[model samples]
Target: MLVSRCKFTGISAPFSVGAFVKHLAVPLSTRLHCALVNAEGGPQSRAVHCPKFQALKSHQKEQLHLYVDALLEWNQRMNLTAVREVGEVMERHVEDSLSIVPPIRDSYLSRCGASCGKISVVDVGSGAGLPGLVLAIAEPDWQVTLVESMRKRCVFLEHAVNLAGVSNVEVVNGRVEDIGNDSCFREHFDVAVARAVAEMRVLAEYCLPLVRVGGLFVAAKGHNPEDEVKNAETAIRSMGASLLQVCPVESHGPYGQRTAIICLKGHPTPRKYPRSPGTPAKEPL
Candidate 1:
C-alpha cells in the first residue's frame, strides 16, 4: 500500500516523471575506488525492485552507477550528504531528486500548447548538485545553472559535472538571493527547483523571483506539505504566483514520502523580493 497522496487537493494519481540506474565496482577516474571498496562496508548496492532504477534505460543506469561512486568517494573527505549507505544513496539521493522531473517536463515543456523548446533552469541551493546535476544529465537540451553559496560544495559540483560529462550545466558559486536579483539571471529562467532549501513561505521568496512570468518553480518537499503550503499562500500571492499542484511522489523504498510543490509565476515578482541575505529564513515572508 505505498501511495503518493496529494492531500487537500483534488488528485488521485501518484506523482511521477518521464522514464529515466545500477551497482558496480568502484568506478574509474576518481582514484579512490579502493577506498570506497572498504568504506561503508562495501560499494553501495542497488535493488532491482526499486521503481526509479527500473525506469532508467540501461545507459542511464550505468551513468548513475558512476555518479554514485564519485559521491561516495568525495563524501568521505568532505561533508556531502548524511545518507552514507549505498542503498540509501540509491533511494534517498538519486531517486528522491529524480522525482521532480515529471512535473518539470509536464509544466514547462508543454506550457505552450505542446511545443517544446530549450529551457533555462536554475537550481537554488544546489549542494552536492543533487537534482541540478541529475537534471542536466537527464535533460540534455535544458540548460541548468546550479547556485550554491559555499565554495567547497561548488568545487565538488564542478568536479562532478566534469566527471559526469554533462556539458549543459554551470555551477554558480553565490547566494540565491544575490543571483535572483542580478539582471543577468533574474526573471530569466523557464523553471526553478529547490530541495530541502528552506520553509515553504521563505522558499517562495528565494525561488519565485528567479522565474520568468508564466514559468514554474518546483519545490521538492517532504511528507507534510499542507501546513507549509497554507502558510505560504500569502507569500505566493504577494510574489505574483499561484499554486499549480501538490504532487505526492511514490518513494517506495528508503526514499520515503515526497512531494513536488509546483508554483506558477503568473506575473513578475516584485523587484524587492528575496529580501536581504538571511531575512527570509529569520522572518518568513
Candidate 2:
C-alpha cells in the first residue's frame, strides 16, 4: 500500500493562531495587517463579503482564515492545490466547499426531521481537505472523517486540521474501497461527500457503501450534470442509492456554476461493490 511506504510528519506541539502566522512564507507584520484588514471588511476583503462567509459566526470565520493560510503555506511545499492566490482559494475552494452545506442540511432535515444534531460526514478522496476540512471548520459540531488514498495529502490534511484547531475532523490515510469494506466504517456515516473525485457512477460505488441506510451521499460536480446523472442511473440503483436532486449552486467566482448531486441511501450496498483499489475508476459500475 502507498501508506506503508510513506513517512508521516507529526506536529508535536499544539497549534495556535500566533504560531501559525509566524510560520507563513509572508512576513508576520504583512500577514497580520492583511488579516486585520479582512477582519475589518476592508475593500480588499472579498471573502468577508461573501454571503456564505458572512453567515458564519465570528470564530468560524477566523478558523476558515487560518485554514486558508495553512493551505497556501502547505501548497508551497507540496502540490496540495492548483489554486494559488488567496482570493482564488477563497472563491474556488472555500466558497465552493461551503456551497454543499445547504443541500446536506436539507437532506438531513427531510430525513431525520427537526435539527441536524451531530451528523457524521465522510469526504471520500479528500485531497487537501477541500470540502471535508472546510465543512468541519464551518460546522464544528459535525464529525468529519477525511478519507484520502495519498499519504502526502493526508499529511497536509493533518497539518491543516491542527493549524485550524478543528477537533471535529479525523484523517484516514487509505483508499475508499478498502475502507468501505471494513466493518468499522461500512455504512457508518450519516453523510458522504466528494468533490471532483470521479464520475457519478464510479463515485456512487466509492461513497454509497460508507453511508448508512437512510443517509445521504453528496457529490460535488460541475454545472449541468444532467448527462452524467442520466448515465449513472443504473450504477446509482445498483449501489442501493437513488438520485434525489441535482441542485445548482451560485457561482462563487470564474470557476462557474456548480451542482450537488444528492443521493439517498435507501438500502444497504451490495458487499462486492467498490470492487478493488482503482477498479471503480477503471471499470466503473
Candidate 3:
C-alpha cells in the first residue's frame, strides 16, 4: 500500500498496490474528492498494466476521471475536441500530455537543482486545454497558464480548471503576440509547452517569447519531426533558443508517433518576437 495526497490541502488516502481502494479527501471543491489509483512505479515506469493509469498520483487519477467527464459533457455542445470516444480521449489527449511530465520535471530540476516548488508554465494555443489541463491535473504543484486566443475555448478552459478543483491554473484569453509583449507575461515563464498548436517554427515564435532566459519550450508533436526541426532552425536561433532533445512519448501506451521537442532558451527573445497576431504563421520569423 502507498499514500498520495490531495492537491488542494495535501490530505492523503492510502491504497494498496494493483487495486484501487475508493476513498475521499477533505474536499474544498467537489473534484477534490479521491478515487481509484495504483501507487506503484518508479519515476519512469512502463511496467503498469494500464498505460495512462500507470503513474498517476491518487488525486490525479480522480482528477483525470473528472476532467474526462467534463470534456465529454461540454464536447457535445461545443465540439471542444476532435477526439470523441472515451478511450481515444484517454490515450490521445490525456495520457499523451501526461507523457511529457518526466521531461518537464527534468527541466525544472535542471533549473532549480534539487529545489522543490511551483515552476511557472504556459500553454500557448491551448485549444480545449489538451496538455495544459492534463498537466495541471497530473502535476498540481506546477503553476500552469492556459493561453487560448478563442473566447469559447478560454471559457471552456476556465470551467475545466474549476471542475478539476485545480487552484494552480489560470486561463488567459488572448493571442500569443498580444500577450507576449504585455509586461504581465513577456518572457516570464519557466516553461512554455504546446501541442498540436502549429508547426515547429511558428510554435517556437509563439512559445519562446514567453519563456524567460534559461527557461524551456517543450513542443509536443507527431513523430518524424526532422523536417520541422530543420525548418525551425532560423526561428529557434532568432528566438534565443536551441534544440535540447526530442524525447519519444513512450509511457502513453502503444500509439502513433509522438515526440516532445525540448528547446533551451539561452537569452532574451528579440523584442519583435511573435509579431502581430497571425504574422508568425504568415511570415514565420
Q: How many Å off is the CA of 125 in candidate 3? A: 0.9
Q: What is the per-residue lDDT of model 3 for residues 1-285, given as tens digits with 9 covering 90 to 100?
A: 001111112222332322311121212333212211222343222222346565677777767767776676666667577765555666667777888888788766775354436788899888878789888887778888888766555656666677778888887766677777776788899899988778888888888989988888999877788899999989999999899888777645445767889999999988875552454332110
Which candidate do you rate higher for lDDT, 1 or 3? Answer: 1
TM-scores of all predicted structures: 0.80, 0.83, 0.78
lDDT of 2 by residue, 1-285 (tens): 112222224322233444444554433123632662455443337656667877888888788877777777677776777877676677778888998999899878986554776999999988988789989988888999998877567766776787668899888777676788777789999999999778887888889999999899999888888988998899889889898888998766666889999999989889874563444342110
Worst 10 residues of 1 by lDDT: 15-24
**Which runs in model 3 stand beyond 4 Å of their true positions?**
1-49, 111-116, 251-254, 276-285
Q: What are the root-mean-square deviations of the candidates from the true structure over C-alphas?
A: 11.8, 5.9, 11.1
Clashing pairs in 2: none
Residue clash pairs of candidate 1: 17-102, 20-56, 21-61, 44-86
Q: Write the per-residue lDDT of candidate 1 for residues 1-285, one digit (tens) a residue.
A: 111211222223432211100122223454343333334443343434457666877766656666776787777666778877666776776777777778788877666343335788889888878788777777778899888776566656766776667688887766666767777778988889988778888889888899989888999888889999999899899889999989887776564788899999999988874563544432110
lDDT of 2: 0.77
How many residue pairs of model 1 clash at the backbone?
Answer: 4
Against the correct fold, how does model 2 do in TM-score?
0.83
Best by TM-score: 2
State the lDDT at 161 in candidate 2. 83
Identify the runs in model 1 with alpha carbons over 4 angstroms from their true place.
1-43, 47-49, 109-117, 276-285
* Model 1: per-residue Cα lDDT at residue 117: 52
